[model samples]
Target: METEKKFEPRIVAMLCNWCSYAGADLAGVSRLQYPPNIRVIRVMCSGTVSPHHIVHAFQRGADGVLIAGCHIGDCHYIRGNYMTIKRAKFMEGLLNFAGYSPERLRLEWISAAEGVKFAEVVREFTEKIRTLGPAPSFEASPRLATAVL
Candidate 1:
């Protein structure tokens, strides 16, 4: 008899260096266990994560993308997370309109002191992505059909 392998989600996490990244680090230091599927990319600020980067992640086969920043009013760059939230929301709308499942993208505010929350968020996001399964290839997506290429 042949054994069937289970599917594991590929998650890309973009974390702000001053807060969300610190939280992730703390999660490790605290020995908190989370799914090993997530690949973390440390950014100077969440605001630096552009829509291009988000789309590129999906294009590169990320089943889900998570952008985590500092809590509102606590950004190391003053107004960085504000821009991040706005862009993420906009991308959600765009993705929905582009025949893509907006649920694939998630944005969260994580503070340096919230290591437990970080682990919880990763676990939840991983489960969600697993349920969604693999995403359609980006080139075949309707959103890119009209592009000049």
Candidate 2:
């Protein structure tokens, strides 16, 4: 028999406090099901998520990163989500420039009331990262771990 492939992708998701974080919490309270591959880090606002955080996740062997925030104009800290949107695009471009597939990073907006949508987004993003395979950035930069630590 041929060797079977194990494709359990490790994802690090950064969620905003006001909306996306509440949405994820609702998903948990409602017993909505989704992939177990995701590990969430809650932030006061998605805008506070810096590119260094994404880079650190990759260095730590995360296969993908997902940034979730409030919907446009729905930021708890007025214009925070707008900053998040802009930072996400910049990070996407930076990933491409660093020889990594931008697909491994996802940006989404989910309101507190959309528990189902939160579950769906996690499931879909997990699937997409699984298909993309493990991130090459880690392999390409063996020294990243040493530097990060």
10 residues in a row with least lDDT, candidate 2? 136-145
Q: Which candidate has the top score in TM-score?
A: 1
Q: Tens digit of lDDT per residue, candidate 1, span 18-104?
A: 999999999999999999999999999999999999999998889999999999999998998899999999999999998899999
Model 2 off-target regions past 4 Å? 1-5, 139-149
Q: How many backbone clashes does candidate 1 have?
A: 0
Can you list the residue pairs that collide in candidate 1?
Answer: none
Best by lDDT: 1
Model 2 Cα displacement at 146 (Å)? 21
Query: For each candidate, how many residue pairs have backbone atoms clashing (under 3 Å)?
Result: 0, 0
Q: Which residue pairs come into collision in candidate 2?
A: none
